[model samples]
Structures are given as structure tokens and as C-alpha cells.
Target: MDVRFQTGSKRFNYRAAGILIEQDHVLLHKQVDDKYWALPGGRVKLGEQARDTVVREMKEELGYEVHVDHTPWIAENFFHYDGHDYHELGFYCTLISNQSYFQKGPYHGLEGERLIYQWIPINELNEIVVQPEFLTAGLRRVPEHTEHVIVEN
Candidate 1:
């Protein structure tokens, strides 16, 4: 049911991502074998609004019920990964959660230990490899208005 399609070495994806920042840190996740981190979210399912995708992914991935605070970016990204050329459309949303356990630094999500989640201090983001690359600097100064970003990597 994910909004993605593949054809002859090319793929297209529709995704929704959430930004959860608390106490000067932002939540990021990556598969156990991956080297880069990305905002916590997943593919947008068919017929689901981007906002709802954020809420659903958080609960499914981290067991946290989140509310969408605001949408900050819609990105169109072109990249090659895992042997496929991909064109991805992503909706970036800010999220708010009342869960206190999330403050405990790093942990694995509800789906076992396949994915690793951590809160990286905002100031130290520049030291890590964040996907889209723009986020390394852009996350430090979230725009007040919704911005459109196009990245080719």
C-alpha cells in the first residue's frame, strides 16, 4: 500500500517525515547497517494525507503518539541507492509528543533492533552525516514558511 513504484531500474516514492526536537536535540534513525541518519518517518500509504502519515509512522516505529505541529518542507529528491535510481517526494513535518521516555537518549524502536533511534543535539548535527545533506545546516534554522527543496545526489 505504500506510494511507491519501480520500473526498469528507476523508482519513485512518496514519503512523509517527522521532525521531533526537544531539549536542543532532534530525533534521527537509521537501519542497523546504514551509515547515514534521517528524520523518523516512512512511506506514505495510498489515500493517506501526508500529515496522517507522520502520525502513523511515529506510532508504528517508536510507539509514540504524535501530533503534527506544522509542515516545513516538501522535498523532491533524486538519488541512487541500493542499485536503483530513485525520485522521491517527501513531506517534512514538525511533530510534538507527550511521551517522557523519549528523553532517555537512544533506543531501538518497536520493530525490534533493526532500526536505531537517537536524539542528536542540534548543535552537533553538523558532525554527522544526515541524508539530503541540506538538513545538516538547514535543520539549525527551520524556515518559518513552508519551503520546497530539490536535491540531486
Candidate 2:
């Protein structure tokens, strides 16, 4: 099972996210009508590799197949949301797509409250809320090798 827990009223999760970039832009998932935006991925299933998790999440969230070159980033995130505390360990991977990937806004994604795909210019990423926050910098100045990050919000 996915790693999760509860402490009093807090909830924690372990997830994997993708960092698909094209033309200096990155794909993001947004909850329509909500002030939240995140990477295009989800929880890593039990016994699933984090890299595979990103691939599976892409298909589930975008209905397209993708390949991962490498897992370039890992995050240990902590935050508070809607009345509960959360701690999420996330894997941020790079995607290599043979098919044309979305490079614009409003691409329909996984079923939810208008959960859609969006491509944000890396330069203008400061305009939205990207969980972990560190991605904001990492994407702009991508490291030569994988980097581990810890985020507490």
C-alpha cells in the first residue's frame, strides 16, 4: 500500500511526480477553480518503483504513454492543508515522450474537478503554486545530476 499515516488530525503521503519539460516550459496539474497546482503525477503504489510510478501516473492523468530518462529529483515535503497536516515524500522524474507532448494550456487530464494539464513557462512559474516549491528553482537551473531536497512548509 502507499505510504500514509495519521497523527491526530494530520495526514501524510508518499507520491511521485513528473517534470516534463519542453521548449523551456513544464507541464503541471491544476485543480480548476482552485488555487492549487502540482506536478503531473500521483502516489507510488505498493512495490512500485518511483520511476514507474511517474510513467503510470502520466498515462492515468494524461492518457498518453511516456518514458522516463531518470529520476533527477526527490523531495521530502511537509505542509498543512484544509485542516490537516501533511508530509509527502515525492519523486520528481524527467519524462521522454515520443509522441507530441502538450505545450500549451488547458489539456484535459485525470478525472476530477477540471483537473487539467497546463504548460507553464519556466520563467513565469512564480505565478503559480507548485508543491515542494523547490521545483521552482530546480526546473530553472536544472542540476547536472539528481538532487535530494527537503521541504517544510
Candidate 3:
């Protein structure tokens, strides 16, 4: 799909993210060409629920099954990056399985390469140059409370 962004035009895109925190560290993927790290999730497919999308993406990307136990942790992040508009939903999930495998995937890296997965501490997010939405809204600490926030365009 071609996303059209006019000058000063505010467009919204729907995407989902999974926050898999283990041992106080979150799982992130490093794009080969970019210094920023991203969470393990993708755009929600048509007719697919957000929770299902997260589960499917985790299985596809990380080669393990995940369980989404609750609603969104962080919601409605508005940000402009690389000349595109993004409004994203970030959810908290628990990693139920321990397994790793490689397969063809999307979100190619700098050299058009697929990323190898890794886990990093939340404190190190700044060093990795993550997406601003994630840096600002997605990483907020909420103890047992999942809250949603809307981002104004």
C-alpha cells in the first residue's frame, strides 16, 4: 500500500507492538542499517485482532509462542519519522516459550538483511536510538496497570 503524506497533512497508521520483558530487559530487534531498535510486532492485518497479530508476529519473528495476557500498556503514539506518520499501539506480553529459529521475514535491515534478535535493558533504550514513540510512550513503567493514551495529530 502506498501511504500519501502531504505537507502538514496528518495521517494515521495503525500498528501493534509487543513488550516482552524478561529479567528487566526487553526484547528488541536491531536493523542492520539503522542504529534504532524496534519491538517484535508489526501492522495488524485486515480482519485480524490486535492480540492475535502480536501472537502471530512473535511466533513468526522470534520463533517462539507468546501469550498476550492483557490489554494495551501503551496506546496511540503519534510520531513522524523518515517522512511518514505513525500511530502505534504497544501491548504488554509474556514470553511463554523458550525457543529460537530463523526464517524469512519483513523489515529488512540496512543492507537489506534480516535482523538477528536480542534482548536489551530498558535503561539502554537511549543508546540504541529506538523509535520516538517507543522511547516516549511505550516504555513507561506501570505496575499491573495497563493504560491507553491517545496521541493528537
Candidate 4:
């Protein structure tokens, strides 16, 4: 995510993310530059619904078609990084696949040069550095007693 910031000012960059949980694990995209992982969603396109963004992002990033369940709006987060501020929404979704779906590919041809997919325990999230919003927002979508939290905020 390329963000520009003004000196001594915070600018909110609008973005969206998705939380994919299965069993006690959550699906995350591991970026190359860092070991930290993130949920499988991206910034919302103009005129696009947040739900649609999750579905589309899954296809583009993971090459799997997904079904977005329930109305989005679990987490809304604001943070500053890389000299800029961000305002993001995290949505919860389910993966729909005709066959076992794993691996990364069919990437939208940008920002995913070394992306890899993995299912990680939710409780272990704190061991790594991730987008805080994704963790906060993602947890709300899962069952209250779930061992793993899906946070997008």
C-alpha cells in the first residue's frame, strides 16, 4: 500500500479488508517484505459495495471464488503508517471452492509479487505485526468463543 502523507498532518486513506475463517484458523496473505500476515481483502473500488470487494479480491488474489456472508461493517479502523493515515473497514466472509483451494496466484498483477496463503491460528496473531484493524474487525465476525479471531480493524 503506497500512501503519501503531509508533514505534521494525518490523512485518512480509505481501504477495506476481509477475514476468512475456517475451523480454528484464518486465511491470511503473507507479504514478501515482512513475515506479518494480513486478511484476504483490499481497498474498495469506486462505486463498489464492500461485500463485492471481498468476493472480487478473493478471485483476483487467491484464484478462488468466495461467498460473502452477512452485511459488512464489523470493524472500522484508523491508523498512521509510512507517513500517512488510513481508514479501513474489515468484512467477514466464507470461502467457496469446488475443490481444495490453497496457494496464491492469478494475482491482479500488482502488489502481490511474493504473496502466499496460509491458515493460521487466530490466537497466534499477536506474535506478529499485522494491520491492527484487521484483527479488531475480524474478531467480531467469528463465533464469540472461537479460538481464532478474525480482525480487520
**What Cα-based lDDT does every candidate model obtain?**
0.91, 0.82, 0.60, 0.58
Cα displacement (angstroms), candidate 3, residue 42, comes to: 0.8
lDDT of 2: 0.82
By TM-score, the better pick of 1 and 2 is 1
| Cα error of candidate 3 at position 45, Å | 1.3
Whichever of 1 and 2 has more lDDT, that candidate is 1
Q: Write the per-residue lDDT of candidate 1 for residues 1-153, one digit (tens) a residue.
A: 999999999999999999999888889998889999999999999999999999999999888988999888999999999999999999999988777535666689889999889999999998889997888888999887899999999
Candidate 3 residue lDDT tens string, 66-97? 77766545666677666776655544444444
TM-score, each model?
0.96, 0.91, 0.67, 0.65
RMSD of each: 1.1, 1.6, 5.4, 5.8
Q: Give the best candidate by TM-score.
A: 1
Q: In angstroms, how far off is 125's CA in candidate 3?
A: 2.7
Model 2 stretches astray by more than 4 angstroms: 110-113
| TM-score between model 3 and native | 0.67
Error of 1 at 141 (Å): 0.8
Error of 4 at 116 (Å): 3.6
